[model samples]
Target: MTYTVNCSILLTELPLLERPAAAKAAGFDAVEFWWPFAEAVPADRDVDAFVNAVRDAGVQLSGLNFFAGDMPAGDRGLVSWVGRESEFKANIAVVAAIGERLGTRAFNALYGNRLEGSSPEAQAELAVENLSAAAQGIAEIGGTVLLEPVSGTPAYPLKTAADALAVIARAKDAGAENIKLLADFYHLAVNGDDVRAVIEDHAKDFGHIQIADNPGRGAPGTGALPLGEWITRSRELGYDGYIGLEYKAPQAEAFTWAIRPVAG
Candidate 1:
């Protein structure tokens, strides 16, 4: 029942190095983020400084994503993309090193969007290969590789918990045992999937869970989804992992609802 802030979305008003402190000030002892550097492999000094920021802020680095291209420019991931395999492979060691340094055990690897000319079978094969490699590298530090189902993009293949699990299965079959699903409720609800059913059937399959109300991707109370109930159900079903707050809120006051008791 612990909570972690996804610094990638929240606290954008502060500098990248300062977001961890901002999260701590907002009462979060742990934080997660997408790749903070523009480059896949940044300078050693940059990496050291980032690690220092989290340590100095007294917040634990709970999760981190491998570089997935320019996220703001509509690049979801490169691992499965045909020509980007080299880039994707090059990032594995860097991500593993960072995870070890930060004591982060959860790593998310986005399945890239489908390419225009590539066949689905080709992309699927590549995804399995790259994911297997990622899982192998992360496993060295006793970390798990997370596969997420993102919403609102048809080109992105994994749009449901089942979809992500299937990919995890493929990776495991390929000899990578550390793969697990990252059940992000906002994406599932936004994609029009039954969020509760996913929780009921696959709560035990999830390694991590993230939440943001649907429709607007805002704080829990700002949307009509039964977030409190869903969270309560997840706990009832024995999901003791962190529930990451990965929403966009205009101000800090939007999180007041997080302090409320869970509905029965």
Candidate 2:
């Protein structure tokens, strides 16, 4: 029930190396970021340098992102370049190397949007197929990929936690164990009919959890939802992994809350 900070909140100002240092300064044990490496760093700026920064900062990397878009509904490389399979596989391989460098083993693989005229079932199958390939590549590098389900607002159609879990289970049945759920509380509260029950019911399938209050998408204490209470309750139910700080920081004051882990 310990917490980790997600580095996406700081991508605007800090260099990649400084992000981990900032998280440590904020009292976090670890930090996470969206895709850290797009190309082999310049001959000047290399992956080892980035990895060393985290070590020097004394923080663990919570997770890394498997890029699915450049911007809102921007080109999702997964389905668009379906024919050029090698490129898609290469994106996943780069993510694995980044994860290894950061001391993290999970990456959030976005399920692509529904294509025009495509059946819902067909879209789900395509998602499964794509993630299966990505998961296999990550597993080879000792990493896991968590499929993040968006309600199609910022990203389309596979918009529910249950929907994502179904595809994840389907992929597992097809012999891929590296695929699991990346549960974002903000997304769930936005789309899910019953949020708390959903978390309780599917805790086992969840590989990681991200939290932000609904509506504002700000820190846990800044929104209308009782996210701090939710975190407390979740720990009571045996969730002992990192709950990522995935929301934007509030302007006036920093949001801080204690996470009390429930003893077994």
Candidate 3:
């Protein structure tokens, strides 16, 4: 299996050009970012230059995290953020173009916050409609959108594996095939669900997996989460996708723990 590093850990300090080298030096096969290119601030970063840097460093660009809005409002998954459908679609198109240039296979698809005066069922419908469009946009370029479930966030709509499954099932029923699930270990831990069972049950629909120790949201060994066991079990469940290390490694030594084989 391959290892990926989430660029969110170094976004504040590193330039896009140097990220690939940094990830390679840290023993990661690929690197990803959480919304590095926002339509609101596209000029702040250069997407094409970042792609060139990845090629020059001989590292793969894994994916991008879609952070459209806050949680609580059930608008974080794929519904809509601030009720701006056109802006959301435009941003997704830009991200997909970046993915295509960088040779990335997946992108994080977030559902925005909950809408005011909207019922839970209504929120789900909105999320599916918007996500289906986003997914279709991504799929045209040979990429997929991975829906993530966050726990305790403002968008508590998809806080569990079961929640993600239900959403995917609905999308499938509606003939949406471009969307998939991104299972984050830290979020799963926070949601208090069995990670192994969740992954096994939805193995086919899972496109990417991310990890961070819960409680502290640090490197895997820094928290109480049983990461090694989960890794071992996931291996058994025929999951061979990249395992993304998406956490704040405050100390240099913290990075060392990332590549060490997990204790089964």
Highest TM-score model number: 1
Tens-digit per-residue lDDT, 172-244, candidate 3: 7787887778888888888888887886787655788888887788887788988877776777777778888
Against the true structure, candidate 3 reaches a TM-score of 0.86
Segments in model 1 whose C-alpha atoms lie over 4 Å from true places: 260-264
Write the candidate numbers in order of decreasing TM-score: 1, 3, 2
For each candidate in the order shown, give its overall lDDT on alpha carbons: 0.88, 0.68, 0.72
Clashing pairs in 2: 1-240, 152-156
lDDT of 1 at 186: 94
Query: TM-scores across all candidates?
Result: 0.96, 0.83, 0.86
Worst 10 residues of 1 by lDDT: 255-264
Give the Å shift of residue 219 in candidate 1.
Answer: 0.3
lDDT of 1: 0.88
